[model samples]
Target: MYACIAQWIPPLERPRFIAVVLYAIGLGTAVALPMCGMVIDAAGWPAAFYVTGICSLLWCVLWFSIIYSTPAQHPRISREELQYIENAVRSSGTSHNGPTRVPWKSMATSLPFWAITVTEMCNSYGITIIRAQLPTFMKNIFGLSIKMVIT
Candidate 1:
């Protein structure tokens, strides 16, 4: 939502708007973490679920109230702005709704796919080795408490 609005602004102005959006997302997470812990500590885990459910419902209400399917339907959209948006969409060749199929069988037979698959397999093997022995290594090396080991 913010990014779409930011696109209409001047190039220099767009970056500032994007930065603000990113900052707000980061700030929201920062605020949420400690508040979530406090709620969990005070009321128990179920209270956190209740809070999340309420927040989700409120977001749905706000989304339907403030947003429209297209610029043409948005009450705040100006005539010139709507024309600009409609033309931009038409020119971009991105507003189509159509089905497409991926030729995965052909891709699997290709050299590039084989190369990628080999690299990914090597990476997965390394991860598998770590996963297989990590808990035993942690238990022996760190000598963690029994509860910590279980969790």
Candidate 2:
């Protein structure tokens, strides 16, 4: 999804756009955490999961309905916006020919790939632990209910 958004953004604006997108994601997570905790406290843990799942489904539906791979393919895009995107793509010298074939065997044996894999694995482990345990930790250590912890 982000790759698609990146493709639409002009090269000169891409860095700032990506930064904003990342910040928005962080902001969303920050907001969602307390909201989830409140929901869990009110209705139980499964209700929080249900709310998130429904939101994900709605987002997917909206994305499929509104988003196009290219400006030309979009039904409601303005002519000026389409032209602007086309001009940017032409100026950037980036082709939309799609990705080159991966050298799987070489990547499998590469030290950099292994390093990145290890780093990502560690990051995922840390995030998962925090996500799965934070509420419990707060409940145990602070003697707070889910709503109280969040509030």
Clashes of each: 0, 0
Worst 10 residues of 2 by lDDT: 1-10
Error (Å) of candidate 1 at residue 7 is 12
Candidate 2 residue pairs in clash (backbone atoms < 3 Å): none
- Over 1-151, each residue of candidate 1 has an lDDT whose tens digit, in order, gives 6534523443445568778977886676555545555666668768867876787799899989987766666899889988877666656554444446879899978999999999999987986676556546765899853236434
**TM-score for each candidate, following the candidate numbering:** 0.48, 0.82
lDDT for 113 in candidate 1 is 90
Best by TM-score: 2
Clashing pairs in 1: none
Q: Give the local distance difference test score of model 1.
A: 0.67
* Number of the top-ranking candidate, with lDDT as the measure: 2
Off by over 4 Å in 1: 1-27, 97-151
Output the lDDT of residue 29, model 1: 55
| Model 2 ranges off by over 4 Å | 109-114
Q: Per-residue lDDT of 116-151 in model 2, one digit per residue for the tens?
A: 999999988997798778878988988988878787
TM-score of model 1 vs. true structure: 0.48
